[model samples]
Target: MTAQTTDTVLYRGEDYDLIGLIAAEPITPQDFGMTPAMISTACYRGYFCTYAIEDDRLFLVEMTLRERDGRYLPIGGIQPVADAREATCSYKDLRIPVDYTGSLRLASGFVRECYIHMGYQKASAFETVLDFSLDAGRIVRVHDRSAEAARKRGAFKKHFEENVAWGIQESFDLDMDIW
Candidate 1:
């Protein structure tokens, strides 16, 4: 299995990979009346979204779609390009306010030793983990769970090293599984 591509989020002036589900009403290519072509096994979802948190509110900053010709097109938060060849030209960045009123998990500083070959890496594999609670796109609370995640990651690493005989560690769940 290929490692899946992750969505990104800009929070507190830093970029973090979004973990697990995105929002209560997750945006998709179909949302824009478009069908995306598979770019690669890693991006089977055919599209990826870039989100940002500004003024305590969440916004969908960008959306890139994979075309059948293997060309990635920025369909959202971009100015219309008269010429297809000028698509690479600079354009204004726009933000679409998202109506997500739920929890979001952001992670960064991935530990290479805890790398997984398939799917998204577990939250525990990251050196930093942040849990955010939002109300209608506005961040109501933030939890810095990095320390707790680090502890879990350390335990997983030790177990993986001791049980090297188990071969590749496909996935690690922080809340479930004994090790």
Candidate 2:
């Protein structure tokens, strides 16, 4: 098990100072009622977020949406959205908006997930596939997967079957945005 750290974050309609840990566990869509995709593509997809709930309440992460390619893309992690009370505000990484309904309040505790490893783009030919992760919130890892591709490059048919880990995978600070 990884070590746990205490941090604060703005989430949903509340700001919480709480304990967090590395999310080494993977989140799968079958974990939810949905299919294999979270953010789906006519061609690709995104990852899943798993969280721990407190007192039967969980920090719900929402994003600002704009339409693209006939689909809604989460442009920012913040902005106007719903909670126990309706409001639009930037909590943690969420984007702030112009007009929204609701009130922002600081809570006694908060928990949020960060993308420690993300945006692994596969190349078509000889380009290196960069798999990145922020180590200790200081160092960044760009893994060259061209060799891995050379060995196992094939047609990607399934959405959730893609090889990638999304969301916080290890101990990280929340409020300071420390990884």
Candidate 3:
């Protein structure tokens, strides 16, 4: 099928089936990190996933969820995003601790996103493991060896990125009282 053909998929808590649009522009490594290899590997390994929302602000999720049987369920939950800017900044302060292990680090280190509802509760947070080499303060490469492993696990599917973006969008569309 051609890229123009839209794909339909089912979602929860809502009757209308959802559709996904493959980004007109495939995410290049430069979009996420300093080098293509890093972005490619990161995208290949579920590291650098980006999605646009209706607002000018950017929302990133570290995990993906689904609505099943009228309840929210986490189909994939890895790192947690903060619920508020304070929480997100606090997370930054704690980045070293989180990145102490290379497991979550990608090429240029991860640009983690934490979703907060202001006075309400925390939505969700996702971290794109950033582990890029730097030379004299310049970005070198994104060296995540999980490419093979991600392929073995089929992490390159386009649905993953779509779902992540949709989840964050849904969170934003909902009323603060509902959450």
Candidate 4:
């Protein structure tokens, strides 16, 4: 597993990297009759999504996919297109409302010390963690758990430094065999 690219979320006029899987309405490349090709190791999922929280509602703002020719193309949102291949739309248009009523974990200010090599990082790897509750895509509540995350990170760092011989390395490269 490689370092996967993160999905973006615009919340309260600020963009934050989504920490974990979004438990929203499932929308895939196959739904649009396209098989996206992976263009780089950083994007193992072959696609990435951009979301926005406007007026307390969650919207799927954009979806980008890698073509076989290695060119990244927009597949959904932000445009009036007849099909997925012709997805050239402006940023202001085409906000697909997501019917998601669940909790969302968003993170920012990545902590380099807690870096993991494979897949989406855990919430603890960030300096700030925001837990959001939604009802049918509308944001119902928000909780900032930055201090708790910081405390957990500190404890992990202390344990690692005291036990592991490699003292406080900036990054930890995991063995591919573990995958």
For model 3, residues 1-179, the per-residue Cα lDDT tens digits are: 01111111111211110111111222222332222121121122212232211121212222211111222222122233433422110011110101111111221111133223221111122121122333322334444333332233322223224575543444323121111
Task: Name the runs in model 4 displaced over 4 angstroms.
Answer: 22-26, 31-33, 67-93, 154-179
Cα lDDT tens digits, model 1, 1-179, are 56677778998889998775444434565665566675567776666678888898888876665544433334554652332552222212647778787777888998898876655676778888888888777889998888888778845556555665442343322222212
Off by over 4 Å in 3: 1-19, 38-46, 50-179
Candidate number with greatest lDDT: 1
Candidate 4 matches the true fold with a TM-score of 0.67
Query: How accurate locally is residue 6 in candidate 2, as Cα lDDT from 0 to 100?
Result: 18
Off by over 4 Å in 1: 22-25, 67-92, 154-179
**Ranking 2 against 3 by TM-score, winner:** 2
Quote each prediction's TM-score: 0.73, 0.23, 0.17, 0.67
Error of 1 at 137 (Å): 1.1
Single out the weakest 10-residue window by summed lDDT for candidate 1.
170-179
Candidate 3 RMSD to the correct structure: 20.4
**Candidate closest to the true structure, highest TM-score:** 1
lDDT for 48 in candidate 4 is 66
How accurate locally is residue 51 in candidate 4, as Cα lDDT from 0 to 100? Answer: 88
Question: Candidate 2: TM-score?
Answer: 0.23
